[model samples]
Target: MDPQLPAWRIAPEDDVAVALKPLETGETCLGVALRQPIPAGHKFALNALAEGSEVRRYRAPIGIATRPIAPGEHVHGHNLRTALSGELAYRFAAVAKATPVRDKGHRFDGYVRADGGVGTRNELWILPTVGCVGRLGERLAREAERRAGEALASGAIDGVHAFNHPFGCSQLGADLDGTAAVLAALAQNPNAGGVLLLGLGCESNQIDALMARIPADRHARIRAVRAQSEHDEFEAGLRAIGDLLAAMARDRRQPVPLSALRLGVKCGGSDAMSGLTANPLIGRMADAVTQAGGSAILTEIPEMFGAEKLLLERCENEDVFDRLTAMVNGFKRYFLAHGEPVSENPSPGNIAGGITTLEEKSLGAVQKGGVATVADVIGYGERTTRGGLTILEAPGNDAVSTTALAAAGATVTLFSTGRGTPLGSPVPTVKIASNAALATAKRNWIDFDAGTVLTDGIDAASDALLARIVAIASGERTRNETNDERAIGIWKRGVTL
Candidate 1:
């Protein structure tokens, strides 16, 4: 056993201690001797727990022990049961205030768009307004890439890719509005120097309607082509987009302050180690960014089921709290409408990785928020204004949640995983691994390792994570982004065309 191992007990009422590493049965740690062998990335009871005693983490009750658990013995599915449903306590003023954190005066090298928004990478985008024009957008993007390479040789543009999708048409209500909002937001994204909008003339979502909401100055960088207006002329659309891409290639990156950044932090393929290390370490990074007066967005509201109360307490006011609570309840209602209880959540992979209940998963999910005050709450595709730490309502599906975050204007994203995932998004995503073995095995995919927090001293682990986030945000090439390889997926709750 490493003598320098650090232990983290998220709650004062926690019954278990997360072992930073593998501990032998007789190893002594922090003056407390291990009563049984504990594996790295697993839990060990810190004190004897009577049957039915609550198990806590993140300072919140996660579940109850089905039987007595001796100190140092593993506390998992075999001995733990899902927490009983009850009214949650929301005591903002009652909880002790945390120590204030200061910013280190750091900033990322990014593109300062004309509108004061900062972009980590500059690219030309092509968007399809409806499924009917998906192929048109794809062709245009391919054409732009082919033509832009001559100037790309001069480093005029990073890359040109058409973001083609199939759900812009045949939608209604919030769904139709959401599709339009995502495309409009993408067009306005600072990362995009230029945008080409391809629309089928008869689609439910029209370019003119979307442009009405967006400012002309920003829309000036965009060119729109309606396939029907041009008699379904794919070649004409490609030529028009090609001309725009040439003009956009001239845009360049400029030095910017940290405050110009809006980031999205999330986790997927989660396991036990996630809550123990990478999640909290990223939480530290989230705190640093928020302290710098930058924005950090935490989404995947479904993944936040049992942990809503923790977020409510941190909300700046009642409105933000109400918005967040309503979103949580909405998800529950949505799931219940389908005749499924929200309690039977967490994918099979999550349980196999040692998370036994949704309560446990929710506790771990909130760690990505760090200790920051919940500044505000926003809905899907809503512009983020009140900055600090804001929560967005969206599902836990990797693509869907990431899509919503990117649409809300996150310039960069921190995606953590334990069982390992290959998903990526349009924004620059820095993949943080939950354990060292996965980080080493998939270095080609993962950008950083949060497992170090469990292996090395906590401070060292956190500092390492901070450094990596800083580097990635500064236009440095993360392992995934460097290859120009990405995992583009969307979480579709409605029917697909």
Candidate 2:
């Protein structure tokens, strides 16, 4: 097979196949003549389809034909229509067993935590207990950074970041509960060595209540300060947070087993090159990480629209497969409930970059999950219990997805892009660009240039990507952090005030 050709057919039922490389008009493939130019990562019909017929990829129905599509015709959003399928109702009765592969038991230099989970980065985190105190938290973090030099140089702290949010104080019902849950999860995230909870004395969401929500065993590592009780002494809050940061800097990375590593994979601003270069390469890297006995997670429910079945077959057991199907159906319900079609996803940027349908986009998106068996499926903001490969329900929005990844206990992240973005998370995000041009153009932000996969052999490119993942896990700073693109976003399913 040509290095650019897709090595696997994700689904056995599909009559369309994705181009692993950029195939121009008239190109011969699988004994069929191309009817139109097909960009890499896009799909072409393997057989003619009458209007209303199913358009399949990854061996599942991605959409319905809007018009007659001749064999070799480009299959995309324009000629396809979103159609909800019965497979979405599929369910598994029990969870799957973990694959019986031997544990690699490798180790990376990381933060050794008392809880047993390893951290890729160690820093003091100051969280706004409520939205009202968000600014104060930010100020304290900035001050701590300035006073301590870089969090590394002063040997007191490497950095301080305020996890500010609009959802903290004024919300009620599920909204408030969700906010508190996510906040507490961030506080317990292994990436932080210590945390300072900054609260507004009068907010509806109290620091003490939030503290009670956290596990008592982890509570000792965190401290809280309220501004309203201090009689206008905001300076005291600043000093308290800053001092904790300095103390946190004294901690250092230690040798930790690879099983302790929890990694998150995400992508945004996708293009044709997205699936071809960055995503698939990251998928292979995910496999490597799992092989080393570490954890790798893939989420963003909407992006999983078309490739849900491929994931189902890979589920370790029937229960996981059921959970995976339910999650996909739930996301579709959410979209329809909002008076929108599920296919309305695959942003305009995707179309311009050669992705013509949600199915094509999804087939490529799930590549980040790699070939590993699905160990578990988790709800939004839930902690992953299984280790080999866990799938968390999340959105494709960069910040929300990264935030969910963090809440799921990922210590580091891998983000791919083709249209370019400056998004980063509280955790280190190693940005991988799909093409050489974007990598070089955004050199300061991209941690690795995956475009070489298109020019160099895919195997060689896969090796380079794996090397970068290991390096980042070992504590190398990603460009997003260095460039100060510290983006923090949460997924909101309801109103917030």
Candidate 3:
């Protein structure tokens, strides 16, 4: 065995180990000679296996072998196939322990709302009740920003912004309700010190109905206008936003405990290095937040396929376990009902980055949740009511899930990526790159480099990352915020009519 080859076996029971660098035929690593060229971020079999044998990574079954695989052979999609199928019964084992609180006395400067919600950003938001007036809302926000230029300069307000989506009209049943709920949740988001709800008089998601969903205390900071009700819609919107700006100007930041922080953990465009570097680093941050008496949310249910057991066992109780199980199986049924398989993931980008199966992808993705005990399971568009690590029901789609995270009240989101994307949520979306190459290549998109974990050690990388997160919570702009890449996508589950 060559001691210098960069390879990692995640656990003692793992039969395959990941190659940290390219390996040529005949090169030896971990006592196995490579039978073929193995690319960096790909896996190599540590021992021979027959067809149909379980292929292990992360010390669990990732897939079944399609053909007889020799020791040292490259393991990838060409030979590995996912074994995930129909829903399986789950039993709570309570494997994870409570993360110990360190009481570091850490704090961040945040805006505290009247409802006692904390905000990392104090901005004015313009939410359109229908897609027909989305552009109008944007124009209104721009005009408000122009009028409130001096207030913005004086730190009385962060900025005037508008969120535009293609839904809100022509949606029925759950689709309409989902749109309304998400929009209302966004309106109540702590980051928005004040909000202006703009609407077209005839829409499924009416302004009045949306307002009814918002909490009473927030009404003082919220204003509404119906485009069809006003002769000059743009002028009316500008006037409403002017009032919102005046109220927002009264909001100010105060020293808030770390326990007030609600963090959203996400990953996208992941590569093999994702599991080894970035993901685990995020896990550490998750642990820190939970230990500090704060809350952290983990979503992207479909990506939790093979690794569901890991989280299910961490549930705080049987009820939480049952809810989590239902959430996992329910998503699987969603895929099957649509004539698709549960393992039909690990996108094209993922395969290129050496993720062979959904199981492999899942094991890596769940690391963002850390080792904290699961406290609650929240439905889509529902706000998080409990602290500690909570599981949220949402799709694995980048924009959709991140939007759900924001709606669930995450003031800041730590998004880990390996292949790279310019996607950002309405809140401050901190982009964590899995590799140094991607970090250097996309400096404008990446906010933190997890690749340093491979060289500097996880402890140092995690400490540095936590510091960066606290800085962001104190109103530092992430790369996404600086690049103006903010967007949102609501999950549509029913007929469009």
Candidate 4:
């Protein structure tokens, strides 16, 4: 690489190259003089282009030129428009092969659940069946934690937390079902050694109905109480949580293989370097875990528009391919149903960070899945059954998608961001920064810096990240966990009655 070239050409066929740093109008890079000043993380034309021509990034058509562009001219939303539209026919031309499982003897200390799942944390989780009782759950958790201070100090339990949300009531049909399903899955999350299900007696999301969804084997570790049935809801909740804390105290971490891991790969507050650095680094980790017989889930379905074909070809079989297709088209129809365009994405933050269109953002975002064959396609709030790369159906909202990943049974989530965010899921969310600058600037939010790929290279970064993940799985708290930045958001798609 030329030291003077402060830009990166992701692919030889790419018509634009990303500026690694600000370039003045007189400065020259890659033998091309700048037509205008280019901001860091933004793109510049590598070759002259005419109006209406295709603009390529990552060797894929990201958008179309709205007007004539000169060589080395800064390219952005002003002159570029997304070419994405309605769904098109897809064919399965398998490109990815089955990954070979290699046992490297890698292991992490985790809690072994009775259902054969492994938990990275041993905490008591208090889940509320209705939004009305969310505060009660929160109070119960605090009371339990305050009363069990000795247990917490003794390493008998990690902590007590109440995951509060606002959708259990005034919901009907799919909306109510979705709320119930997500709460049920969270209640069963392995990270929670024991669970207290607190409910308001009369609500659309009844505790009895939610309990039916949970597997029988997890019943021993879960306790349920209806507030309206109790003389004093707060006191009853506290007692229930106390019992859960006692049960959780008996849980301990044990060694488990990498195959037992379920990882969630995601990106948010992305920038130009996101695809170049952090995302791909997470992809390497995904490939490593999948190849070791573990599972990895890739969501943010709408972001997969321009690059859905690439993922389609990676489907393991016709069924999975069809499922993937349905998922994509289904989400597209959802956008249309709401009278919205399908390609309406690349949030304002993304544009300022050098991402011009959803296609460009997606081509980079999909890097989180690496090149592994997709083993399954799951709906919202569903758990992963088969190990490998699985695509989930969800929108591009960061908190919502991250929460879905956890509800779907991801023991840990690897979130790549160029612009930093303090957002986290119920599980440990490891934030990987795309550039060293963001990592340094937001030390509290960033967990790992993938920008080192430009200096130390990807292999070193991947190794370091893998080690960090193992440590996290072994109970080393991520910034989010330590800072108590945990929350959940359910995907609501129906009318509120």
Candidate 5:
């Protein structure tokens, strides 16, 4: 980490060093002069690479060299190809657990819910059961906001939002079920102190059916309206919002243990520095949260292609291991079922940002889970009932996975990006920039500069990150919240009727 050095070898055994800055042909890294210009965040060979030999980064094979590469030569998609293939059977290897630190842990101010869950924000949410009534739900929310301006200014409730999706109607079987599951899960999120479920009675996803999906105990906090059946749908929706707000007016924040915290760790728009900086830094925060007897949810199943073993080996038990194994394979099957290769990843942006293969991207991506033992693997839109690291089943898309995280009860989500993205989830999303340049350039979108870890080190950076998370939990708005970039994306995997 010498300030004078412009390249970083992530591990002592790594065959490549990531360019810390743009370098010319004459610049030396690892005692090898660059053979070509290397962009910042790009990788360069530290030693001669033989054709068909494995190339390593993060001390693991990222891909196979397509041709012989001289030392200091740029390593990229042109010469490196992913070695990933079809999924294989996995055996469970139990990892030792860290003793819970609940005897002493961090605390945050949150709203305690009737179900014993804690809310990072006492916000009111409107969920439309069908797309037909989606705009109606928005109108209701806006009217509610207009009427509650005084209470909003007084912090009676956090800002209100209507989460509307397009596939509630004509979605059959699993697709319809998926829609209902995420919406129900959203209602269950403690962040939604009050919820208004607006529905058009004629839709396939009826208010009655969706209501049945929710727990009976949570019914009191969530009010529903059948827009088609009501004589005046708008008035009925407004009345429902008023009723929910009345109940929330008495809600307040109280000190809660970290065990009450459920964190969702995600990364998008990643670069080489993502692994070296942001992801590992978030990993520190993940381990800290789990060590304190809290919960951390990790998703983006496809990204786990080459590096899933990092999690499989850490499963708390054989059952957890088996479930995670199934989850990974199922996703691969999903890709193949659609005539797509499981190895098709590390998007164009990823390549431009120095990631050459799905394997390399995954190795970096999974770092966000830190080193915590896998406690459980939950299905998409399911809540994290376990109190350590839980893996949720979801895709690698930023929108879909972050929505799954929030639906799974993540009061706050930690999103790391190196290429930069303004996307935010239903919950408060704290964006950590992988490099200082992106952080500086997108101040409005970036929350923390994890790039500092390259200079300041991870220990301090992680502690600072956890503190920032606690503050965010205590009602401090994230960059996403301040910029109003919050939204939800339901996973639509089934056929439309």
Candidate 6:
């Protein structure tokens, strides 16, 4: 997009151009004079469109015209509707593997764990087994912070945090399975030098079950407490923390290859500029890391709807393509089973930001994955076992999805936003604003301004972003960390019995 222009068309085949700024009635753009006012970030037809004609953006169908749209008229939700209905079938049509960027030997100062994984931050984590003991975990974390104040001041560890989610109890089957799986994965994150597995004894998400889910090798670094069984749970937790901190004090940062790094790509509160700027900018960064032999994970399954084919075709093999196909249709079935339309997306906020349909949102959202070959299809809460691009099964909720990314082994997340938000992930979330206005308005929240891409161009913007991510991996605090915006959200599905 050219900020210098009054309006910009994203692709050659696009039938509409998004207003670079609010366009008044009778303004001339794209060889057509505007018939009505168009809000900046909103779209205007490039040519006449008959009812039911496909609306193209990013060289793909975003939706179809619900009614006749005259040239230069506003193209938005009022005139457009999603063409998607339900599950889709995908045939494996392999695309050439995208070449990785030239390896420049990118490295970051990180803590090397006994398991050979490197950590961007060495922190103590307190995880509650069930919602019943959530506050207990928080209290333990606070007291530990006070006890470890000197060590914290001396940088022995990053910080102590308690991730308390309200589902472990009264949950059955898959619900309990997901809760335990995520808790176990979080404990195993290289960032958590030590973990306090706090539990309320009588929950379906039992401490024993969670412990079993965690690898035996990781148990040495984890301290589990049955709050109900302990005489003084707080004191028990404090003692456990004391022991863990003492052991972690020996951990120190050392230079490691970029291959040890895992990057998670995400976007939230998107607007029209998201696809044009922030997302593609993040894509370049993802490609850089992957090219250097590092790993990258992309989630938000619902947002992959219309763009599934783009990702599916890039799969490394028939197995991956088949798995991805199942995952996509399964998510769509999840919506239908709940009696909701699959295209019931583009939240009011998305619509206000000029997104007309789920197709438009998905097309923009997948740009974060770049052109990397699809390495694998990972289940919810499962960690990425190999490097390259892994597609994770997750919803589009800001917190839940990002938390899933962190659990899936992302040490740092490059989060893109157009509408802007203060939400952060368990890992450091580097917020990239889609426009200059947003970056300026949320200076404290935004870590990078991809809006520069409008003038500076993508290659220049991407170079800066990759450098910023490397610095973050080397222990530089992101805006999210400095603002104390770190949080975790667990997805709740299945019955609560």
Specify the highest-TM-score model's number: 6
Q: Which stretches of candidate 6 lie over 4 Å from their true place?
A: none
Worst 10 residues of 5 by lDDT: 96-105
Encode model 1's per-residue lDDT on 17-65: one tens digit a residue: 7766677878775456777776665677788889998887767777889
- Would you estimate the TM-scores of all the predictions? 0.90, 0.88, 0.98, 0.98, 0.98, 0.98
Model 3 weakest lDDT span, ten residues long:
1-10
**Candidate 6: tens digits of C-alpha lDDT, residues 72-111:** 9999988999999999777887566796677778889998
Model 3, range 156-240, lDDT digits (tens) per residue?
8888889888788888888899889888988888998988888889998888889898889989999899988999989888887
lDDT of 2 by residue, 328-447 (tens): 888888888888788776788888776767777888898898878888898776777667789998888999889888988888888989888888988998898887878888888888
- Measured with C-alpha atoms, the lDDT of residue 338 in candidate 4 is 94
Better of 2 and 6 by TM-score: 6
The true-structure Cα RMSD of candidate 4 reads: 1.4
For each candidate, how many residue pairs have backbone atoms clashing (under 3 Å)?
1, 9, 0, 0, 0, 0
lDDT at residue 170 of model 4 (Cα atoms): 89
Against the reference, the lDDT scores of all candidates come to: 0.76, 0.77, 0.90, 0.89, 0.90, 0.90
Error of 3 at 472 (Å): 0.6
Error of 1 at 235 (Å): 2.7
Worst 10 residues of 2 by lDDT: 1-10
Model 4 over residues 93-201: C-alpha lDDT tens digits? 7557855534566899999999999988898888888888888888887788889899888877988888888889888888888888888888778888999898899
- Candidate 5 Cα errors over 4 Å, as ranges: 96-104
- Predicted structure 6: lDDT: 0.90
For residues 350-452, write the lDDT of model 5, one tens digit per residue. Answer: 8889999999999999999988889999999788888889999999999999999999989999999999999988899999999999999999999999988
